[model samples]
Structures are given as C-alpha cells and as structure tokens.
Target chain A: QQPVQSPQAVILREGEDAVINCSSSKALYSVHWYRQKHGEAPVFLMILLKGGEQKGHEKISASFNEKKQQSSLYLTASQLSYSGTYFCGTVTTSGTYKYIFGTGTRLKVLA
Target chain B: NAGVTQTPKFRILKIGQSMTLQCTQDMNHNYMYWYRQDPGMGLKLIYYSVGAGITDKGEVPNGYNVSRSTTEDFPLRLELAAPSQTSVYFCASSYRIMPFINSGGGSDIQYFGAGTRLSVL
Candidate 1:
C-alpha cells in the first residue's frame, strides 16, 4: 500500500524551514526519501532504518519512528534548490522486497 | 556507467495500440522496477523483477506486462493502450544491501532512467 504524506503542498522562504511527513498503516522496515525537480527523476536523499535513528546532511534531516510507523523530513534554511516534490518510499516488514512510494509533497522555496 | 537507460523518451500511441518500453541497466543490479507517474502524483509501481526470468506484479499492474529475459534488460509491454495509461514511465535498478555491512539496513539506492513519456490517444 502507498504511504500517506501530510501537507500536500508547502511554500517557504529561502531561509525558512519546512517539514514533510509520511505515515503508513503497516509496520515499516525502512523509509527512503527522495526529491524530484520539475521534469527530472527523483534523487535519493536519505534512508532511515527501523532503529529510529535521525539522519542529517547539511540542513536536511529525517527521523524515523518505528513505534508510529511514520517518518518526517526536515529541511532547514531552505534554499532555492529545495523547491521540488518530495516523496517517501517505504519497505514493510512483510518481506515482500517491494518498495512503495508516498503520495508526495510539493514544496516551493522562494527567494 | 550508464546506470539505467530507457528507450523512446517520448511516444504517442492510439487507443488499442500496443508498444513496449525498453529498459537496460549496466550496474549489474539484481532488481529492476517499472513505475508510472501521473500528473502531480508520486510514482506507482507497475511491475518488478528480482532476477532474470522472474517477474511479479506491483501495486498497479492492471494494464501492463513485463519480462526480465536477461539481467541487463527488463521491458514493459502495454497491450490495447488506453487514454488512462498516458503518463511518464520510469525504470529503476538497485542492488541488495547487506544489513550487517550497511548502517542503512535496506536495499541499495535505486538509479532511475531519464523516463519515457507515453501518451495514449
């Protein structure tokens, strides 16, 4: 099943912060985040495993909550390059070896 | 490496027409997937293969078919195309990551092709 993403769309200033959340009904083994610019393929951001670790790179960070079966992506001091659609891919505990993507959240960062 | 390559970047097919979208990967990955993306929507998996000669349906596999004849190639076939099938198609390949060796504890990152834009008239 596809995961659900909150705040279908968001607009932010270049120096602002934004959060995108993905939730699944089933138990997830891992969550993968990607960002796709207009007319481009999705690019891998980061992957969070079941250990509930919070991973970060630059001003981008993500957290996985095993208990809630959800994940949240944090983009701080958003840059113009951050304008794009964000998606979260999930792998369930069923061992199906299939990755399901979320509905997606569109974020537009303005100067 | 031309990680993942897809052919016929743009195509238009009449209703009832049939076509095949070709995908090839040089990364020697064991897993390949076909996904479709509609306007303003995330990708929907249509089919996936674990290895050559093995294929399985994904979330939305109603009007499509796929075959993995060789490790390097996986093709998606559309039969009797309909207007609803008009969308952008993407092919991705990835290798399995060992949990013990990787802290991420999941499959390797998927490399996507440029994507094929199909329009069914």
Candidate 2:
C-alpha cells in the first residue's frame, strides 16, 4: 500500500528548516526518499532500513521506525537548491516484489 | 551505465489515440516498474514486472496495459488515450535489498529513467 505523507506542501527560505513525514499502515521493511526537480526525473536521496536506522545526505537526514511504520525527513538550514517535490517509498518483504510511494510533498525554497 | 532509458521523451495525443512508451534498462535487473506522476499528486505505480515473463498491476493500472516478454525491456501500452492519462511517466528498476551500504550488481536503490512526458489533448 502507498504511504501517507504530512503537510502536503511546505515553503522555506534559505537557512530555514523543514520536515516531511511519511507513514504507512502496513509494516515496512525499508523506506526510500527521492527528489524531483521541475522538469526532471526523480532522483534518489537516501534510504533507511528497519531497526531504527538513520541516514544523512549533506544536511538532510531521515529516520525509519520499525515499530511505528513511519519515516521522517529532516531538512536543516534549507538551501535554494532544495526546491522540489519529495517522495517517500515503502518496501515490504512478504514475497511481494513491489514498492509503494507516497503522494509526495512539494517544497518551495525562496531566496 | 545508462541505467534506465525511456524513448519518446515527449508526445501529445488526441482523444482515442494509442501509443506505447518504451522502457529499457542496461542493468540486468529482475525488477522493473512503471509509474505516472501528476502535478502535486506524487507518483503512482501503474505496472511492474518481477521477471521476464511476469507482470502485475499497481494502484493505477486501469487505463493502461503492460508486458514483460524480455528482461531488458518493459513497455507500457495505452490502447486509447484520455485526458486523465496525461502525466509524466517514469520507469525504474532495482533489487530487493542493500544498495545503501554495499555495492552490488542488484540493489534496492531503483534507477529511474529520464521520464516520458505525455499530454492528451
């Protein structure tokens, strides 16, 4: 099933902060994050596996919670280059070789 | 590596028109997927294949068809186009696990194509 993300849209300024959250009803084994620019394909940012692990890219970090079936992305001191749509994908291990992505969070960073 | 490549980067179709979006991956991945992204709606999986002769439906597979006759290619066919189907299409591939830490031929990190932007008028 597709995961759910909070605060569908967010606007930030340079040196500000923002957070995007993703939660799923089904148990997820892993969570993946990707960013898409205006007219480009979605680019992989980071992945967090179960076991309460965390991964960081530049100043951005994501945390995966096994018990809660949720993941949160942290954008600390945002930059202008951070403008884009963010998607969170969840994967399970029930022999179902498929991954479901969230609706997406649109973020606009203003200078 | 070219990773995943999609043909016909942009196309416009009238009502009832038919077309096929071709997706190919250079890496020999067993898993391939097709997704459509509408403005502000994120990405929805339309179809996916686990292997050469296997295919499955996703959330938004009603207005589309797909086939996986070969491991190197997965093509999505629109028998009749509609305005609702006008969206950016993306093709991706990956393994089930472990692309974050270890480098492997097949990892969970899905590589996406440049995408095919389709518009139905």
Candidate 2 ranges beyond 4 A from true positions? B97-106
Task: Report the lDDT tens digits of candidate 1 across residue range A1-111.
Answer: 789998899999999999999999988888989999999889889999865889998999999998899999999999999999999988777654557889999999999
TM-score of each: 0.93, 0.92
Interface RMS deviation of candidate 2: 3.7
The 10 consecutive residues of candidate 2 chain B with the worst lDDT sum are B97-106
Fnat scores for every prediction? 0.58, 0.71
Encode model 1's per-residue lDDT on B57-109: one tens digit a residue.
88899999999999999999999999999999999998875442343554756
lDDT of 2 by residue, B1-121 (tens): 8889999899999999999999999888888999998866688889998889999998889989999999999999998899999999999988643343343322577889999999999
